[model samples]
Target: MARNTIRKDENTTRRSKKELILRLSVYLKPYKKESAIVIGLMLFVMLCSVLNPYLLEIAIDDKVANHDVMGLLEIGGVLLVLNLVAWAVSIIRWKKIYSINNNILLNIRRELYTHIQDLSFDFFDSRPVGKILARVVGDVNALKNLFNQSIQLLIPQLLNLALLSIAMLMLNVKLALVCIALLPILAIAMFCIEIFSRRRWEIYRKKRSNLNAFTHEEFSGVKVVQSFAKEKDTNDEFKHFVKNLKKSWNSAVRLNDMFWPLVELSAGIATVIVFSVGYKLVISGEIAIGTLIAFSMYAGMFWRPIMNLSSFYNTLVTNLSAADRIFDILDVKPDIKDAEDAEKMDKINGKVEFKNVGFAYEEGADVLRDVNFNVEPGERVALVGATGAGKSTIVSLLSRFYDVTSGEILVDGKDIRKVKLESFRNQMGIMLQDTFLFSTTIMENIRYGRLDATDEEVIAAAKAVDAHEFIIKLEKGYDTEVNERGSRLSLGQRQLVSFARALLANPRILILDEATSNIDTQTERLVQRGIEKLLQGRTSFVIAHRLSTIRDCDKIMVVEGGRIIESGNHDELITKRKAYYGLYSAQYEFLNEGA
Candidate 1:
């Protein structure tokens, strides 16, 4: 995998902030009634806030100027009532917004999770788990913040600006026009800043994701790092990556920082101009002192909303960048999918056929080239080959993990691609050289093979694979917890548990890829006996490193350079003294010498 390509160019077809907000609103439409209540409460809060400035104007113009004691008391009482109403409205809006934001976050998280599950394995194969986690958790959270804060303020902020502008203009048109004129310049500045910040932010996000992937991969392979004494080298590499991340981070923040102080400076200039002009109007008897005072207060209040709009504009850019990162994952089309008219196969007879099959992970370098093979129902086929000889690739194709580049793979005489993935995979059991066990109880792990299987059925499967005895010795028996990746169990034990899991699935086709390679000789013999019982009357394919495991297989195939050069039963192959014979004899002598 090339690290350079991890951060691609920004998506050319970027969605505008308004378009994103509209799409998010549609998602919230299902809860329209609650949304309506939230909007209403927010409006009430804005109305109360606007009334505060008006109250100050009235106090200066009417009560104070006229020296009416009774009028002053009545105005004070009304002000108190307005404050109380504002507090109530604020609380109601807070609760409603909080509830709506949480619900929207929950729904988005759930949808993303479900969509991830539906994606093909190829997507997971290329992307790191940590990067995926960041998109699902971190990026989604950023979007939620944007949706909750930006959206809730959107209508109220616009309305406040409009109302304040009108109130200010009614007092003095010249001053209002001055403030309005500055807006276009501010708008152009904001647009330029947003464009620069978006690109910088995208770079920062990519670097962050790359750092996450590197950290996750390193930690997961910590034992290997320690065993090879590569700690210093790894630490230095990590520091280099972090340095790149910090540079991008600082660049993004610096660009955003420049916008706000400039806006504040412009606001200051606008204020000085308003005060100078308004003071002259009052001195010349052209305007009343009350009107001049009101105009000054409204002028201050008016710029506040504009300042907030500027801040919101920056925030909107940040949110959109985060949203773009999230949508990138959701937008990726899965490389593998069943045909549109695919149907479920309830009973698979286990007969597999590959006709003129060719495949490559990358084009032109064929992993399996023009290969053809057939295994009848209940036949045991052993594939023997050196590394990179396409043995594992063949099994991967048979299981439909990757579709053939050319030709077709048929299971029970029907193309595997024409069967629903769930049904197709359910009919086959695969055990790899390295087994994976979830952090769960023993019983639950086994039951994962057949989700609806009863406890009794689980124990029966474990017993069949000779895993029941060791499981019972654990403190919790069937309920014994297998910590992360079953680290508590020995290698042989984990392999046996995996065998039992496969048995529980009761698959018609079985694939064993060096399943017993990690066990001791004694455990190997025990597992071999269990495997014999498990493989009885089932169509099985065995990829073996130790030749003894496949000596009794009905057919032995020699795969070399992506083609089967020789194939026959054990006795016939040994007599032929071909590739399979040479491999078997060499391993046979090594084992005998050790004995």
Candidate 2:
């Protein structure tokens, strides 16, 4: 397997702050009714807060200092009732916000996953799984926090500030003027912090993603590392990734920490200025003592939401980078998509044809050039070649995992590219050298081949592949749990399960890529019987490593340097004494030496 270089530069995808918000809000459209209700509740909640200071003003002026006991009690009762209503509304509002936030997260993650599934093999070839995982997991999680703040915090805070401003100005223009003057300074400070913090966060996220990629890669291939005794080397590489993450994490945290204090300092300064002026006005009788107290209370209300807004701004700036990374993946249009006029291939007869096919993994570097071949329905064809000689590429093209750079692939005499991808792929079954099984019961793993398959049908498929005996022998039988990647099962057992899965699909065309390479000779004999029956009446392409396995192929093509150098039956090829002869002779000699 080739290790692809990680392109660090691709992580720094940037979008304008305005565009990011607008794009995210698109998810909010589906739940507009809930959003509206939440916003309305926030408005009423702002009214409740704004009314408190004015009520205090009246309570102090006309009841407390006036020594009217009943009036004071009445005011207290009103305040209590108001606070109760505000609290209740807040609880309901947040409940709704939480629901909306989770739904949006679910939708975004689903969309990302679906898009990734549709992408061509080349996309996966170019990027590591960890990089993609970061976007799907960590990045999506960050967006959830932003959504929560946008509804439950940002919108309400802005309304609170606005309503508080109006109430303050009506009560006393002088105090209100002084309080509002600090707004511009707070805004400037926030702007400056946001600019600096955004860059730090972007770097931090990239480092975090890099760390995740490295960890996933190492753990996934742990066996290889242990076999080569490269644990120390791998640990060193891990430390290198962690050190980079720590530096970026520290830098981002340091910048983020500075934000709260600046916001609090601005609020603190506003408080001092308001009180210094309000106290003198009260002493001079220009404003009543109650009015002075009310102004101070209103000033607190005003600055509190400013602090909230500042917090929201900080969150927004940091998460904006995450949003950009997510959109980068969503923006990748799949290179292979059904054409506008593509037809649905309902029932394929599986006559495969490659007409002047040419392909390349990269430009000007052809992997297969002008490759031409044809397989009539029910023909069993064997593709033989050295490593990287393009045997696998041929199967990939036939399955339309990739499109030919030049020429066409036809199924049932119609160009496959002109057929709907899903319909075309549904009729094909592919078994690779490495078979992947999900963490689930053996029954479910086999049923994955055809989701609609019945339990008996699943067991029947397993039986067809000679997997039933071992499966039934297990303590749990078909219900036995296969751990991740079917790690608990032997490699041969895993391959058998895969064969059962592919067989259950019952595809019109079958592709076997070194499928029997892992089985022991005894097991191989049993599997071969099953395979022969499975291959009957289907167009099959087999890539075989063992020369003997392909002896029964109707036609054998000797692939060399990305072209079909020769084609004949096994006996005819051995007699020709060319490339196939060389391969057969080497294998025969090896088997004889072992004997």
Clashes of each: 0, 0
Give the per-residue lDDT of model 2 (tens digit) for 432-540.
9988999999999999999999999999989998999999998899999998999989989999999999999999999999988888898898898789878988999
**TM-score on alpha carbons, each prediction:** 0.93, 0.97
Question: Each candidate's lDDT (Cα)?
Answer: 0.82, 0.89
Q: Report the poorest 10 consecutive residues by lDDT, candidate 1.
A: 1-10
For model 2, the run of ten residues with the poorest summed lDDT? 1-10
Q: Which stretches of model 1 miss by more than 4 angstroms?
A: 1-26, 593-595
What lDDT tens digits, residue by residue, belong to model 1 across residues 1-595? 2122233323323677777767667767876788778778767876776677677778878889899888888888988998898898888888888888888888888888888887866677667787777678877887766667655766667878898888877778987887677778878888888888988887787777778778888988898999999999999889987998999999999999978887888888888888788778778888777777777778787877787777777777876767777666667766677789999976988888889998888434888787888889999999999998999999988888888999999989999889998888888999999999999999999999999999999999998888999999999999999988899999999999999999998989999998888888888877777798889888999998888888899898889888888888899999998888789889878978999
Model 1 alpha-carbon miss at residue 391, Å: 1.5
Prediction RMSDs, each to the true structure: 2.5, 1.8
